[model samples]
Target: EDKVVQSPLSLVVHEGDTVTLNCSYEVTNFRSLLWYKQEKKAPTFLFMLTSSGIEKKSGRLSSILDKKELSSILNITATQTGDSAIYLCAVAAQGGSEKLVFGKGTKLTVNP
Candidate 1:
């Protein structure tokens, strides 16, 4: 079975602080790894990593994949209270039906 694990299940930070979240996975014929941020309801897509060592960035958020290690990392800079949310990591495997297997997620709380 494919599995994803996220480190530091939860974190507390003040406004303007930077945070790093880690995710590792094990799956057969891995296709990609995706990151999502969840707030009130559904999760919002963050990044999708397929090739190793290429970092994907959007504003203060960025992510990179390490295929050799079967892992990925998400970095958030200058985090604000508005950035408080659950960060989810999912992996897509190459198979008949494309499905994403998600991790429990890392809960981040950015205080004012």
Candidate 2:
């Protein structure tokens, strides 16, 4: 079965601090890896990585994929209390249709 594992299950940081979250996966017929940030409600899309060595960035958030290693990393710069959330990593596999297998997620708490 396809599965994803995220490191440092939880994190605590002060406002303005930077954080890095790691995700590794083992799956067949892999299509892509996606990152999402979840706060009080549903998760919000962060990035989608299909090709290795390519970094996707949006403001203070960025992510990169390493296909050779079957892994990905999410980096958050200048985190604020508003940055506190659960970061989820999911892998899409090619089947009849694309299906996503999600990681447990890394919970980040940015303190003021």
Candidate 3:
């Protein structure tokens, strides 16, 4: 199960101030999360967060950089579990605007 939560759904701010609105979640089969910033016309994509790692997976849906091919994939893996934790994303969009979407999946298979 996976869910995205935006704390303090509402807030008040002043000019020349720095604020951090938080979005937290707990996912069993966590894969990817996208952040959107909407002003008026349809919302635009801000960024994508995957359980895999930024954009560094390769081979089996892993992200890797090929200096020769001059290309890369966002499905690579090489990390530590202790260094694992969901990234907290926050954005300030128009009132009653913006949303947090949840997604999951990858090329990881665990077998005995």
Identify the leading candidate in terms of lDDT: 1
Worst 10 residues of 2 by lDDT: 92-101
Looking at model 1, residue 45 earns an lDDT score of 97
Q: Model 1 shows how many backbone clashes?
A: 0
Candidate 1: residue pairs that collide? none
What tens-digit string does per-residue lDDT give for candidate 1 at 1-112?
9999998899999999999999999999999999999999999999999999999999999999999999999999999999999999999999887899999999999999
Q: Candidate 1, after superposition: displacement of residue 108 in Å?
A: 0.2
lDDT per residue for candidate 3 within 1-112, as digits (tens), equals 3355554343333333323334555544334455443333444554554433345322322232232322223321333222122223322223343444432211122221
lDDT of each: 0.97, 0.96, 0.35
User: By TM-score, is 1 or 3 better?
Assistant: 1
User: Taking the tens digit of each residue's C-alpha lDDT, what string does model 2 give over 1-112?
Assistant: 8899998899999999999999999998899999999999999999999999999999999999999999999999999999999999999998787689999999999999
- Pitting candidate 1 against candidate 2, the one with the higher lDDT is 1
* Cα deviation of 18, candidate 3, in Å: 0.5
Question: What is the Cα-based lDDT of residue 46 in candidate 3?
Answer: 43
Q: What C-alpha lDDT does candidate 3 achieve relative to the native structure?
A: 0.35
Q: Tell how far residue 84 is off in model 1, in angstroms.
A: 0.1
Candidate 1 segments exceeding 4 Å error: none
